[model samples]
Target: MTERTAKAARRARVLDDIDLRLLRALWMDGRARVRVLARDLALADSAVSVRLRRLREQGVLAGVHAEVDPAVLGLTTQALVMIRLSPNTDSRAYEERLRTMRSVLGAVALVGDFDLEVHLACRDMADLERSVTALRDAGAESTHTQLIARTVAGLGQALLTEEEPA
Candidate 1:
């Protein structure tokens, strides 16, 4: 391998305790200020800032976004739709097309009986039905829908331990 590729591989393996702590803090609260993060983690502000920059540069840290309530935003209907495509169909093209659809919030290319799993958000049941029908007409062989009751644990909590630190 080339020198640049070797250096990149080496950098990927270099996460220490402080780096983990910094990631934990940000995962808990993406909106956390650099000063507050430094104080909470007992590190210098500059150190935290530098670490955050490095994380972003390395593509380990993606963009941060605000969590919005679906009900308040008029998106009252949410469903997990599993789609089965016809044999020999290109799943990647179908996934890419579904991602561009307005009602589809997230899409995952899957294995087993279903080719794609899609998360849809809509204003009501009617809208959700329409979106599903559109997907079926577009090329899905069959589809199944399951309503999302609630998120028991969010991403941050799921990734980190629930127990409080001593």
Candidate 2:
């Protein structure tokens, strides 16, 4: 078989039915106990533990993280920033810098008119302006920002309910 075909076959077999269900359960509550997960998945506690370890080892499951409330951090304003940089700028380096910013919740690399989409939680509009200024200094050629009125769903909400890989 060709290399491409073999790679596709390997990707298809990565996750089975039990892995999908376990992923869904963990997505909802990362802190769930092994016993609780075993009960939910109809598996033995030891089996659940083994599956979880395998998932982590395969890099399929990143570490669990707490979803913090921006309000609790005194951040009352939320904005989505669409940024475009000069063709010569390095997007990966800029993304890494964004990780060091206190207001940056997350950032995505885009392929269309925009180069990056950044989610920011700030104390107020003034804080957002500061972030915009920093973006320009960091090599953003142009930026368009919009205030987020509300969030109906979070990232990966749609993908979370899908079945296991074929």
- CA shift of 161, model 1, Å: 5.6
In terms of lDDT, model 2 sits at: 0.87
Q: Each candidate: RMSD to true structure?
A: 4.7, 3.4
RMSD in angstroms between candidate 1 and the native structure over all alpha carbons: 4.7
Question: Model 2, 1-166: lDDT tens per residue?
Answer: 9987876567447878788889888888889999999999999999999999998886677789898889898998999999999777898888888988999999889999999999999999999899888987888999999999988755674454555534
Q: Candidates' lDDT values, in order? A: 0.82, 0.87
The TM-score that candidate 2 achieves is 0.85
Which numbered prediction scores highest in lDDT against the true structure?
2
Candidate 1: tens digits of C-alpha lDDT, residues 71-121: 787988999999998665677778777867888888888878888888998
Q: Can you tell me which runs of candidate 2 are displaced by over 4 Å?
A: 1-12, 154-166
Q: How badly does each model clash, as a count of residue pairs?
A: 0, 0
Deviation in Å, model 2, residue 65 alpha carbon: 1.4
